[model samples]
Target: MKQIFAFMPTFLLSVIFCNAQKLTATDVNSPEVTVVVDIKVNPQFKSEVKSLVPELSALTIKEAGALSYNYYLSPDGNKILIIEQYKSLSAFQEHGKNLFSGPLGQKFRSSFTVNSIVVAGGNLPDSVGNFTVMKSIGGFNSKCE
Candidate 1:
């Protein structure tokens, strides 16, 4: 799998990763787990945040067990949306550890406020405060097939 991704250009990788967010599995661990995080950023630091997006995203999708990880700016340019999908809960946790302990995580803590965290795939705690939960009914992505 690593070799398959190895030959693709970085931008193409990003497109694939971003598109994978909308796909689903028929069962838990089949389609994998996903986390949609909404990050709130003020106008001042938007460029700084955007500057780091591509590098950060490239690093993430290359990691073992990483299915998807990408960021988007809201229409107003004040909000950041991170769409993450992992092959398993463990993979998601691995990404989380890297996220909080790595440079990107540090930058995020100092520069942005977390607006929301939502879980999908029935893996862990469902409704905690502002979180929304989702279960995959059915879907298909040619890339996954």
Candidate 2:
């Protein structure tokens, strides 16, 4: 009984130490800037915008430190939302300059009658607290876990 007790403590201590020493990547990069841009295109620009999306996506994904670059269309299909992320401020600036004078940019400018273009740098806010957790799942009652 004494030997078993002694072995149990040692095993428990080893497990605790192993779990406590779990290390994560220290070099992971966070979003340098999150650009939430709203672009309104003229009704006639729809075809042009659709044609250019693939080219724009390819160019953006190839850029250095490009994290997430996605564009979404609104319900009316006339408004566009662009969310872009970069690893650092310098990468973002370089991309911005390159994009403005690059072929894709020219195409975009010529195609769309932009109602507004808003570019700002910030991180997206967390919404964990806004979510509700259901206590239990039941019949006819929707439960979220």
TM-score of each: 0.67, 0.56
Model 2 lowest lDDT segment of ten: 132-141
RMSD of each: 8.5, 17.4
Which residue pairs collide in model 1, if any? none
Off by over 4 Å in 2: 1-31, 113-145
Encode model 1's per-residue lDDT on 10-55: one tens digit a residue.
Answer: 6586677665555544554464788899988866677788777876
Off by over 4 Å in 1: 1-25, 28-31, 122-132, 137-145
Query: Best candidate, lDDT-wise?
Result: 1
**Residues 1-145, candidate 2, lDDT per residue (tens digit)?**
9889979987887776664444433222333554556677767777677678888888888888788888888767788888777776567667777788887787777666555433333332332123221221112212122
lDDT of candidate model 2 versus the reference: 0.62
Model 2: lDDT of residue 106 = 79
